[model samples]
Target: MRARTAAERVACPVCGTASVRVHSRYVRRLADSAFRGCPALIDLRVRRFRCAQQDCAQATFAEQVDGLTFRHGRRGAGMQAVLDRVAVMAAGRAGSHLGQVLAAKVSRSTLLRLIRRLKGPERVTPRVLGVDEFAPRKGHIGAETGFCTGQRNR
Candidate 1:
């Protein structure tokens, strides 16, 4: 499918100044989620707006649609979310197969990259700690004992 952005004015990312000047326009080919068991593609025409601020670091910035597009993204947000879920659940090879079955068509390496990009879950301190010592041999006088520790979250 083909579509174009209709935003009249967009704010500059660096200076926060709204700009209505259009520097150029380009088409971004995005892979969208499956539609009725078929792969979907969106050719979105986005405008590049020139920053109005004189001291802004960014001279031109492309418009991004909320819940649909992101910076340097080739897939739609919905498809990205689906792939993220698959990456978390199945991991590399399995996640790639799952993505193909879902009509997303991603590679195992891509899934692994996605997994690597994800932030790890926050660590929580355990509430209870237990320690125990066990001897290697019951009757041996020179046997060494090993200590083991365990923790409980709640």
Candidate 2:
């Protein structure tokens, strides 16, 4: 329900300064996985640390918990994982209905959005290539090779 940053200091993003000076604290409400068919929630209290480097443009920065959540993200890792799988398994409207049936309660547009966020398969050029040969007439004597592209000796 409630949580706080355990780290004494956090590194500044701009100049990489490990700042120990405390600036402020903020509560980030994250939508987590469901508990007993109910949507779970987490109120994470994070701290903002002052930048130690004088030349650093950032005055303060927030501490992040590894594998817990990311900046500006409202959903937790567990919740995101479920939604991602649902989106992949079914298309937008179908997945949305499935989400509601499972008590995940995601909108069709949200499911579509989540699916769109995933990166497509990487395209690569093959180093070696092969082609299949079809049989035009199997019993033909002279036309044995079928139709293949190669050097012909007449």
Candidate 3:
């Protein structure tokens, strides 16, 4: 386990006060990328502190790295790193299965949710939009496709 935060001082995001004291620390396990067939776990010991500001909006918040967020999840950030790779190199059930094999403990639906989380919201105002769902192969009863018939947005 590595120290999540050192003695380096951090000011409150909402305030400029840098007077804070370390109160305690805890470990958070996150999934990281995989090597071959094995998954990696990142054990981060997060620190807790008390803000000395009398009018601060927030009393405390765990420090976050550039690509990480607190309370976003309990799984390791490494898991999302791996999920990102799988999402890019694979799609649909295959990616889901790969995530499961890596001990993500996620099902196909969960995997899709993870993918959607990574993708975030779509903001494109395209001239045309197409939505469809299809069977993995063919000759399946659940095969479906969707197409937009609306005019192009300006």
State every prediction's TM-score relative to the real structure: 0.79, 0.72, 0.58
* lDDT of each residue in 1-154, candidate 3, tens digit only: 3436564776666676774577667887766556676665677777666676978987876655555535657655566666667776665688878767876655566656666777556797777643423233333332233233233323
Model 1 alpha-carbon drift over 4 Å, by segment: 123-154
Candidates in order have lDDT scores of 0.87, 0.80, 0.62
Q: How good is model 2 by TM-score?
A: 0.72
The candidate scoring highest on lDDT is: 1
lDDT of model 1, residue 1:
97
Range of the 10 consecutive residues with the lowest summed lDDT in candidate 1: 145-154
Model 2: residues >4 Å from true position, as ranges? 125-154
lDDT of 2 by residue, 1-154 (tens): 7777788878887888898998888899988888888877889999888899987889888888888887777888878888899999995899988887767888888988888899999998877764432323343323365444353434
Candidate 2 lDDT score relative to the true structure: 0.80
As for candidate 1, its clashing pairs are none
Model 3: ten consecutive residues of lowest lDDT: 142-151
Candidate 1 local lDDT, 45-145, one digit each (tens): 99999999988999999999999999999999999999999999998888888988999999999988999999999998877754422333343233233
Residue 80, candidate 2: alpha-carbon lDDT: 84
